[model samples]
Target chain A: MDLNIAVLAGDGIGPEVTQQAIKTLNAIGEVYNHNFTFKDAVVGAAAIDQTGDPLPEKTLKVCLETDAVLFGAIGDPKYDNDPSAKVRPEQGLLKLRKSLGLFTNIRPIKAYPTLIDKSPLKEDRINGTDLTIYRELTGGIYFGEKKLNEEGTVASDLCEYSDFEIERIAHLAFKAARARKKKLTLVDKANVLETSRLWRKVVTKIGESYPDITLDFLFVDNAAMQMILNPNQFDVILTENMFGDIISDEGSVIGGSIGLLASASVGEDHSMFEPIHGSFPQAKGKDIANPIASILSAAMLLEHFKLYEEAKAIHNAVEKALELKVVTTDLDPSSKYTTTKVGDFIADYIANSE
Target chain B: MDLNIAVLAGDGIGPEVTQQAIKTLNAIGEVYNHNFTFKDAVVGAAAIDQTGDPLPEKTLKVCLETDAVLFGAIGDPKYDNDPSAKVRPEQGLLKLRKSLGLFTNIRPIKAYPTLIDKSPLKEDRINGTDLTIYRELTGGIYFGEKKLNEEGTVASDLCEYSDFEIERIAHLAFKAARARKKKLTLVDKANVLETSRLWRKVVTKIGESYPDITLDFLFVDNAAMQMILNPNQFDVILTENMFGDIISDEGSVIGGSIGLLASASVGEDHSMFEPIHGSFPQAKGKDIANPIASILSAAMLLEHFKLYEEAKAIHNAVEKALELKVVTTDLDPSSKYTTTKVGDFIADYIANSE
Candidate 1:
């Protein structure tokens, strides 16, 4: 197989982390006898600094021309603190998603055996907790029509959902659940919001086709509480964009550190994989930031290409690194392992593994 | 001082737990040399059974005539399972909130030393986690205009906020923060939602007036994670209706059991106190439900009337009961105390304290 990968190593520690992911992908390509070509594209604050645009037109063209895009984190303290800034780094990512038609975000959370004690939750509650969230990324309140009155006394955001939008994500979620646990839980506020009620109607209708997969519903409020009390009960959590953003972030803490979670954003025509953690501006160039999430994101990229065995090898390598305490300062603050060293360990394991 | 108290012990364990609150309040009245008149009202499922209305006109009239309403839990499994049920128990509470103009909901969460082990969170993370949430109850998306297209293929819910709505709750929350920790955290999605940006602007402006209070901001998604990761860092969390519904419910699990949390809803004209937990239909007649939340609600009612000493006495008695292992089965499944027994113990403590 031949693949062209666009690397959007945005800012802060993004370049450092994406470099490790590229190395691991290269190793996988060599072992699996696949041809891979990597192209670099500037984005976020880096793109802004160099090209005066957070997402340069050249970068978007590279992403569209490639088979898949591997993204690193994006953000800067300068952009974050200035609320009055005319252009921001986040707008770049949002625009890229819109331009690429990336509508679904997949976040998989697994509690690592060695890292259970790092969680604020008790071990028993977090033990054996593994679930994936299928979030509708491009729709809902975030992208809806936002209006502020002329006098600036009133502000509103419209949360809208169409049947086509719900159906596309529902099929993806149900298929994912059927492949894994044969259960899917749709989280929405059906009792209050018309959009939620429509979600129930459409999802329920679609669920009828997948009779083997059990479908359940939980209000977002109750779902939030259940995420803490009994995370093991969920198989695949499906929700609209806003609820997904909130719940997925909440789920990140279940495994102790956001540094270990990876996500994939996929549409019918395009796909992008990235780490869930933000770019730690303070840790940039320090070689102390964790790269496991970026490495796992590479694994997700493999999975997206249907390279199941290659993805499994990367996941096993991560598990081994974690178990052996060969991690960066974020996971083991007392240790002296640098970011590149930890990534090197994972890559070495992947290269040496059968 | 003379007080008119309306007791609306709605359904299930609501009656059982509320009876205990009344007993404790009566004890306080006697010890403080105050005249107290108790009136009974019907609400929720019980009212549906007797008066064909979840909240009867008589119940509303009684609540209006009183200085404050002492409410129990409300709900039934029958209505919960039947999605088509129009006349539900929750509707009563919604109507009552709107009818009485209860805009700000105050929920105080405290991690008791003895009950800290009940939390899903680690003891260290949950320790010293005492915070209050002032939620805007009657506004935001929950009560906003909802619309569905004629073809039934599209739906939308408007999340609207005005300066007036934000100011009222901001004042209440800021004042509450001043009295306690002098810290206020406004949780919203300001970067995306117009309403949230308005919230930030209004709150930031209002924060200027209270220079002594340290004000901060956290996006709702980050707030959700912080709630579990570092709950002790928060003092007073202020948010809109839907965000409040999610966060407060999530906060309830920090103490391990929902049965230990109490809440107060206040407006310009009236206020009502209730336990944060719902009607436990399964444990209704078992005599095993926890009554501490209800007793604490009564304590909050006392505090609302500026009876600080009386409220302190009730709180001290409840603490003694908990420390002495005189709790109900919910708190101590191995213990032999019943609902009325726990209530009796608390009442006895209040009576004998002076």
Candidate 2:
């Protein structure tokens, strides 16, 4: 089967990482005999540098035409320290989500056995853990009406959610749960936030439509605590954008290394895949930042296309490489291999295994 | 100074743990030459069983009459498993906050060098980590309008925060920062939640009034991650109820055990002190649960009264006692003392300390 992939290597270490992902994908294509085409797009600080628009029309056009987009990291530290800057790189991400209608963000968390000892948690607590998070992407507080009082002294952002926005993501979570462990945890501040209350109401109703699924509600606070104590109890975890942003990062810790995590952000008609790790701008061009997350992202792209065998092949190669200890410094920084070397090892593992 | 302390030993091991706190307080009185009187009150599920009111009128009256209230653990396993129960022991504590106008819940987190290694985090990360959290109590969604659709299927809780609510807590936080390290991190979902944005804006404006205090913002999610990644970076952390409920628990992990934490909920007119840990109904009356948190709560209460020397005396005693291994089983289950035994040792240390 033929697939068209959009590659948006936004800035900093994005291009370097995405290049490794492409190389990994080429290895997968060679082994699996799959046809894949790539289109490059600019976004974030880079898009602003090129066209003075973070989400330019041309970039969105490229994203719209592709079956899936592989995104690298965004944001620059320059934009981060300035509290007064109006057009920041993050705005572009928010705008892209809104424009593309990418309403569901799926972040899968699994603590690999090999890395359990590396986690801050006791090995027993983080061991044998696997879970997926489905965070409602397009709505919630991220897009809410924001106001910084004219004095620039006071700021307020509105967090409003309609039942319609809630239903779509609920369906995604329930569907993801069915394919996993048939359990769904709807994480919300239902005991407090009005938007969260609306989310719970709609999700609960949608849950009834899938009677076979077991569902539970957790206040975001308890959910945060529970994630640390017992991440394994969760199967498909669902939440809004803000909660998702925090929990996903917390979940990243479970993997023992952020570089091992991958995410999928999809909507009713569009989808994108990326590494959950941020731009290690310092790691730019060093060939030292682990590219496995980006490579695993490519694997997830295949899974989205129902190319299960191809996805399994890539995963197996990464797993084998990890067992063999051919990893970047982030995992075992003392390891002799650099980032490109690790990518080469994984790609070689895939090619050899086939 | 003459003071009347209202003591409410609520449930499970409430009386057991509270007894130790009293022992420590009495030691404080004897050693410091302060006049103090203790009044016992009923609250939590036990109060519900007695008068069908969790925070009885008499209890409130006693609390109002007293200079401070010492609260023991609340809730029972019976109430925990039954979600359908209309009135919960937690509701009583929440109600008490609203009724007493306890607008700022202050939780002081300081890592004990002796117990730092007990933490899952590295010693360097936990050492010398002292943070005071000013949680905006009696506002936000905890007191918001809760409604259920007629079908009883859809439950909604409204989270509304007026500028006034944010202003009060913001003032308390800024005051706290001015007195301490002069750094305040406003933890919020400003990018999403309207209440959070309001909190961020109000706090930023409040910072202007106190030029020495450093102010910044962290999305609740990032804050949660940062709390674990490196907690020492913060001095005074201010956030709303829901975020506070979660981050404080996450903060407990920094100290190796929540059992070492203490908290105070102070209002414009009244103040309350309690351990950050809840009723471990299972550990009730077993003489096994740790009471350092309770002992530390007393220390915070003393600090509130401007009895800084007296407060330091108690805190120093606790650190010394823990270093000597006179600790409850929670900290070291095999330690050669029961809960009361450890409390006695601490009280004795305070009394004998020159």
Candidate 3:
């Protein structure tokens, strides 16, 4: 097998962590007799500093030509402080998503047995809790028309959903449910919002095609509570963009550390994988930032490509690292491991795996 | 002191819990040597069942004539099953809020010392966690104009907010912050939504008047994470209606059970107090419903009237009840106390308080 992977090391600790991911990916390729080519491109604040644009056309073209993109974290304190700035690093990522036609965001939230005590949630409640959220990225309130009256007193943002938009994501969610668990929970405020009602109608109609899966509904408020109360009860959660953003971040805490969460954004033709954690500017170049999220993201990229055995190798190594306490300061504050050490350990573990 | 109160025991465990809250309130009146008159009125499913109206004119009249309304949960299994029902128990509550000008909703999330271990969060993370959410109830996307395209392909809900709406809630939150921890955190998505930006601008401007209190900002997603990460860092959380509905419910789980949470809706001239938990129709008539939420709601009602010592009496009694394990099945699955028995104990405790 051969793969052309574009690496967009965005900013801050992105390059350091993504270097580890690349190291791990190369190790996997070596172990499996796969040819993997890595091409580097600048993005986020680093791109802004170099090309005066957060996302350069050359970088996007590199990404489009590649089989899959391994994205590092983006944003910088420089842009974050200046609200009046015309160009921002986050804009690059958002525009890249739109340009690449990436519409569905897949976030896998699982409570690892080794790190269960790290979570704020009781071990009993969080243990065995494994769920993935399929959030529609391109539609809903985030991208809708916003307005402010001339008086500047009233401001409004439209929350719009089309059957076409809902159908596309609903199919992906249902298909994912079929692959993993046979249950899907649609979280929406159906009784109140017209868009949510449409979502229910379309999802229910589409659900008919997936006869093997059971579907259920929970109001957004109740769903939020259920996420904390009994996270183990959920298998796959399907929701709109805004709800997804909120719930996925809430689900991030179930693992106790944001460093362990990995996410993948997919379209019909193109897909990109990245760590859910943002650029930790303070930890940049310090060799202290956790690389597990980035490495896990590479695993997701493998899973996206249907390379199950290869992806499993990466995950197995990660679990082994956690069990052996070969982690960054975030997971084990007293551990004397650097970012590269943990990544090297995982990559070595992957190479050494039968 | 003399007071007239409207009692609306809505549906399911509503009537049962309200009975206990009323018993405790009456006991407070006796202990404080105050003349308190209780006027009973029908609302929610009970009102819809008997008068064919969820909020009868008679009920509104009684509520308008009273100092404050003590409400229980609403909704019925019947209404929940039929989505096409013209009148819902919740409509009455919504209409009641509008009619009474109850624009500000106050939800206090406090983890009890005795029940701290009951929370999904570890004791260290959840102990001494006390925060209040001041949500603007009647505005934002929930009540905004909703539209659907002719082909039923697209749907939109407007999320509109004004300086006036933001200011009204801001003052209350700031005043509460001044009285409590002298810190106010405004949670909104200013970077994305125009309404949230308006909220930040209005709240920031209004915050100038309170030099003694500190004001901060957190995007809704980050706020959701921080709520679980460090709930004790928050004093007063101010957010829009939908965000409030979501975050407050998320905050509820930090305290272990929904049955322990109580809320208040207040405006310039009128106020209404109720438990945050909804009608559990399955638990109706089972003698297993928790009355502490409703009883604590009575304490909030007393506090609303500046009856400090009287409210303290009710809170102290309820705390003693929990400390002694004299709680309903929700708090303790193997508890010997029934709903009425727990209420009786609280009322008796209130009667015996100094």
Candidate 4:
């Protein structure tokens, strides 16, 4: 098997985590008789500083050429504090997503029994909680037309979504649901927004194709509430871009640390995998950032290719590390392991166990 | 002082719980030297059944003339399940909010130490949890224009917000923060949505007026996740309409039963007080409804009038009933009190003690 991978080691701790994921991937390659080629690309603030474009033409070209892209973190405090700055790091990420045609963001939230104590929810409420989120990445308010008033006192952002956008993502969610728990919970504000109504109508109809998948609808507001109250009741939660953005963040809490969560954004020709956690600018050089999420993202990449055994190996490596208390400070505050050490431990575990 | 309170007992446990609130309100009237008038108004499914209107014109007239409106619950399974039904019950509530100019929906989530075990969250998480949500009712997507495709293949809803809408609601949130812990967190999807950017721009400006209050912003998604991870970090959360709907519902989990929380929808002209819990259509006419939330709504009504003593009296009565183990089945199965019986206990406690 030959794999072409685009590596975007974004700003802050992104490079640090990406290095660990690369090490894990290399170990997987050694164990499995696979040939792999990698291309490094600049993105976010780094790309902006170098090419004056967060997502340079070369970076997009590299991403397009690769089968899957492994992304590190992005964003910098320099851009975050300077709200007046026109070219921000986040713009690069949004642009990269649009350019790559990565429209569906799949975030899996599962509570690990070993880390249940870390969660604020009760054991009963959080235990046995496993759910996936299908977030429409490229549409809704994210891509909507924005306006600022002449007086500057008022600003408006149009949250417009065509039926076409909603249906495409709805189809993905239903398809995923049909394969998994056979339940799809559509989260939208149908009572208020035209887009949500379109979302409900389109998704409700699409759901009919997968008869085994029970369809239910929740107003985005109510869905947020339900996420906390009874997260276990959900199997697959399908939502639009904006709603997905918030709910996905909220869903990550079930796993104890958002740092431990990984997400995948897949389109027709390309796929991108990354940790859901943001670049902690403070942890850029500290060597304390968690690398498990990035490593797990590599696992997801393998799973996407139907490499279930390879994917399970990576997941098991993480689960094993947690079980043995050989984790970064985020998981084991008393441990002396650094980011590099945690990554090394997981890779060694994978290699040795194999 | 005399208060003519119009009671809108919509459907399900609406009549049952409103009966409790009324009894509690009337009991306070005797001790506070306030004459009280309780006029019953039909709304929701009950009204749709009787007058072919969820909120009849006569009912709106009564509400217009009242000092305050205390509502129970609304909606029924029949109306809830059949989404195609033309004269839905929730329409009346939405119309009532728009007509009454009820822009602010205030929900207070406080964990009762005695009932911590009953909460879905861990005891430690719930013990000191106290959150208040000021949800904007008449703006954003819920009220936005909805469109359906010609072929029924697509559905869409527009989510728009004006400068005025954002400003007024932000001011209310800031004011509430000032009275609480001097911290305000604004939740929005500024990373993607233009409406969110408008929200941040306005709220950030409004924040300047209150230098004493520490204002912060979070994407709605992250806010949802954080609400579960470390709810103790928040003081006051201000967000747009759709975000509020979800956050408030998730927030209610801190208090255990949804039936234990009350909400106040306030405007310049009139205000409506009701339980935050939705109408449990299945519980209608069952006498098994928990009236605590409705009773607490009565407490909120008194507080709105700045009748601190009157409000305290009702709150104390409620506390004593809980202390004595005289509560509805939802609270404690040992007592097994009916909705009216629990209401009577609180009313009796207030009348006897005061």
Query: Which structure among the candidates has the greatest TM-score?
Result: 1
lDDT (tens digit, per residue) of candidate 2 on A219-311 = 887788787767888999999877888788777775578888899888877888999888888888888888889998988888888888888
Over A1-354, each residue of candidate 1 has an lDDT whose tens digit, in order, gives: 899999999989999998899989988998998888999999998888888899999999999999999999999988888879777898899989989999999999999989998998999999999999999999999999999999999999999999999999899999999878999999999989999999999999999999999999999999999999999999999999999999999999989988999999999989999999898999899998899999999999988888989999999999999999999887887988988998898889988987
What's the lDDT for residue B33 in model 3? 90
How would you encode candidate 2's per-residue C-alpha lDDT over B1-354 as one tens digit per residue?
A: 778999988988778888888899899999989987899999998998898888899998999889999998899877778878877888788888777889988988888888866776666556788999998887665666655555544444555677777888888888888878999999987656666767777778778998999898888878877776678899999998777888887776667778878889998889999987888888887899888888888888888888888888888888888888888877776787898998999899989986
Error of 3 at B326 (Å): 2.2
- lDDT by residue (tens digit), candidate 3, A1-354: 888999998998999999999999999999998898999999999999999999999999999999989999998999988979899999999999999899999999999998988898889999999899999999988999999999888899999998999999899999889988889999999878999999999999999999999999999888888888899999999999999989988889977778988999999889999999999999999999999999999999998888889999999999999999999999998999999999999999988877
The DockQ-derived docking category for candidate 3 is high
Greater-lDDT candidate between 2 and 4 = 4
Candidate 2 chain A: worst 10 consecutive residues by lDDT? A149-158
lDDT (Cα, tens digit) per residue for candidate 4, span B1-354: 788899898887888898999899888988778888888889999899999999999999999999899987788888788968899999899889888899999888887777878876777666687778888888776666566567765454556777888888788889888878999999888776777888888889889999999998887767777777667888888887778888887787766778789989998889999998888877778888889899999998988888879988988888788778788777888767888888889988888895
Give candidate 2's TM-score.
0.91
After superposition on all CA atoms, how large is the RMSD of candidate 3? 1.6
Instruction: State in Å the error of residue A94, model 3.
Output: 1.4
Candidate 3 TM-score over all chains jointly: 0.97
Q: DockQ for the candidate 2 complex? A: 0.37
Question: Best-fitting candidate, measured by DockQ?
Answer: 1
lDDT of 3: 0.92
